[model samples]
Target: MKQIFTLGTLAAACIIACAPAVADTATQPTASAGATSAASTSESRKLNKLADEYWDALARFDPVSAGESGDNRYADQIGMSIAPKNRAHQFALYRDYLKRLHTIRRDGLAQRDQTSYDILDYELTTALRFEPFPEHLLPLNQMDALPVTLANYSSGQQAQPLATVKDYRAYLNRLTQLGPWIDQAIANMREGMKTGVVQPKAVMVAALPQFKQLVAAKAEDSIYYTPVKNFPSGFSDADKKKLAAAYRSTIAGRLNPALKRLADFVEHDYLPACRTSTGWSALPHGMDWYLARVASQTTTDLQPEQIHQIGLKEVARIQGEYARIGPKMGYNGPASGLPTWVSEQAKYKPFKTEGEIIDVYRKLNAQLQTKLPALFSLRPKTPLDLRLEPELSRATASDHYTPPAADGSRPGVFWSVVNDPTEYGSTGMVTLFLHEGQPGHHFHIALMQELGLPDFRKFGGNNAFTEGWALYAETLGTEMGLYDKPEDWFGHLNDEMLRAVRLVVDTGMHAKGWTREQSIQYMRETLGYTEAAARNATERYMAWPAQALGYKIGALKIQELRARAEKELGPKFSLPKFHEIVLGEGTLPLALLEKKVDRWIAESK
Candidate 1:
């Protein structure tokens, strides 16, 4: 899942009390040296205090985010985030934070605090810059939406805790608010219809099934009743009975009806009104919107045309790799036909049950764990759990990771979406495990939480750093000797090709006005995705602009930085140390990451 950055609850008082304050004399030039030092120290203290306050306020504003981060203090609340008044209040909060941040002297902050200052300034500025756009009008999409997210939570195995009686009641309270949230979503879409900011017709058509499936005939059959079926061991029969009754009531009385209403409304009202054109460029001020998304998602200044060209070059380069390796795999065919040829190989589709598919990932994890110490000196303390993606969400979901609870009550989970084990291929398992499980998200995210970074840095992430690091992790498979087999190597390259194709296809659609069919065909030919797979991937880009671009763009940047480090440091460069430098500061924007690496090289020299 993409990282959600709503407000979270941290102990503001404790954070402010324990935070260190130090001075830099650069900004207070007119004062005497001692006076400058004191002034700088005071300003630094104030900035730290403000950072804590901001985190606390965010938790109150978006309790679901807070709960996801393991702050159960707000577990009972689910705020109306998309409502106009709430959105105005949220934007006003951003403005206030920005105005206050401008009062601080960045030059006067100590080096560590300066990084915090810059990050906060960038975040607040970005939020306010997007204020003019009515993102609330289009609340949900096929790729991601509140309903899908909440459904995942209702399973009791996701971010929402269901370990105790209080946990159960907290979820019940959260469900009570979903009805109003749905009502507000309908209202927002109505507003969007008037403003010409609605979702495209194709996007809505793909999203319809998600809502429709939630409308079960009885509350007992609803996904929200999942928790009741699997009560914790210690719960008394009386408590279980009461909780189950409460769940059935809430699901029947509040949740199911809201879902049915949403499904009906989308099928009847919203689908017809949705735009026929697939590109974001078709909407009002859409080119600007797409540009902003490109900048924000990649955290780079590269224009869409530049990115598009880079993608085209990358596609050609990866195809060359395929040609060189194809003959080794007993396929003397052209590079374009390699993936299709591999797909037809019976040996690759060996799994017959979900258990067998998961066991491959387990075995991969165990094999990779022994090899990790050679490359990474720093690793996360958090344990990772492997599981199948819940049946309700598997259709639309992809393989992904969810972070462990901040309190350590829950372990990080890698969910593999296996809709059909018979059709599931085994070639991607090794690289997939590397990217979504160990040493990738599990290591990067869990280690960040363990490092005791500031609340904002701990819970927040940008796609470039997070997704880029995962893609980079996939390349490590070659070094670890996991891709020794011809078929395994093909799998790794095929996955890489998908990311490369994303660059070409995402930009082609959003910036160059490529049609949905064009995007689907490009993916099918380049990556050997089946027609269904290709269509699903195409609609994903349509629903989420600039998101797919992050994997390749981010991975390339990290690779570039690694290459520079190797050349500059020579024998002195340590692979583990280089990784430490990259992953040490949590999820930084690409520019900040580059600066950090450059500084490390200079210091080591």
Candidate 2:
């Protein structure tokens, strides 16, 4: 999972869905005296000031997101974002910004400023559309919830810093608020039961162990005790003792009991009320909600049926490639048999220890560095580091990338989850590294942060662009000569197939009334995944609807643009320049990206 903090989505359409309003506002007549160049300059200045103010207000509004991006001013605060009063205030803030934004004349601004205006408008409009939906009712899930985020912070290895005495005290202050947050979360879940917006029963069952793991009998045994055990070497014994005592008291008095209460609430009160139906359509007004998710996630107006058809076509196409390669690997079996044959081979599972797994990725990083300059004129200055996933998150987590801090305090890290070395497959290693490590997320995200763009573009993302870029990066493996072996190529296709499978399964469950078991069985037959792998994949989609649709949708769009550039430009084309154009601006919605690429092609001619 690539960690992206996406803004909300528009209802049932692309960003262009809101363009008529912008167009109307832009064309309104201006007063004759106020229509001079001075007026244009004033509007531009006002827009710039608004951008700055919005970023600052957002930092205070969602401090965790700000802290992750390397803003430390609000490190001690965790606002009650889900509470009704706070939610209302946040919506009012968006409405105010949007109202002020419309007063600026978009037609009079510079091209760059015009782009920023459109992006900000899209974000505000999309966010406001979600006001009718009650996302606050379900605050936590088996994956990517507040608890998982907080636990990652406690390790002292994530975005939260523990480098000084002040840093330690700030964290303690943050923990003091956890009890209330948990209580509110439980209260919200209870409200959800009445409103018919609850999570699936299986997801709640899966989340129980996560809460249980955090309820330790003693503070010293808690995961939050991590910082206390590894104090900075410069700390005097007196300071260390005092900080440790404070941590122990906070964890025992505030954190542990809160965690236990949450665990008990889920087990006793919430489980019986969870919805057994797997898809979003089962809830109130769910079909509309799922449609909104589709538009927002893919940044397109693609309907569920349209996306499902596209997935089917892509799956068939990839399966043909698999059949073509299967003969060369000395296996004349059917394309569906390829995954099993590859997995059963002892040669692919050679690692006896975790160290060997890390070594394999390090070597891939070294090999990739020498090949990057040939294809990319724009590369990130931020370094990419490899680390194993922490023990607590490893069970539920996949291999993922975390972006570097804005202040350069931390480097981007690719966490490889090595649960059991002997069971880890090696063929996927090359493509996995390509997708999560180097020229994939690290290159795109780190470079975006490094660019001199608006704060929203730097920190905000569209899932289609982010995941699509990573999936497209996997295809670059072939051009880079990383997939020299038949097995390696098979791994690439298999991973692609998983994304394709997601298109079928995600919509099937959420829009077409597919059961969890039905989805799991379809994955096993198509990708040759074991029952456990298939189940995990199904549950992930169940937890996050329409998110999986972005990978293949975004990748195909990029590939389409590249092919168009190649055919039109012929000998005049430069791969590096084309890449620069696609990635030069920070992340864009798919429609905006198409317009940008088309403009670049026209200019080059």
Point to the candidate with the largest TM-score. 2
The list of candidate 1 runs beyond 4 A from truth reads 1-41, 69-72
lDDT of 2 by residue, 287-363 (tens): 98888778778878898999999999988999899899999887788888888888898888999998999999999
TM-score of each: 0.93, 0.94
- Compare the candidates by lDDT and give the number of the best one: 2
What local lDDT score does residue 444 receive in model 1, on the 0 to 100 scale? 93
- lDDT for every model? 0.81, 0.82
lDDT of 1 at 177: 88
Taking all chains together, the TM-score of candidate 1 against the true structure is 0.93
Give the per-residue lDDT of model 1 (tens digit) for 415-455.
99999998898888888888889888899988989887787
Which pairs of residues collide in model 2? none
In angstroms, give how far residue 332 of model 2 lies from its true place: 2.0
- RMSD (Å) of each candidate, 1 decimal: 4.4, 3.2
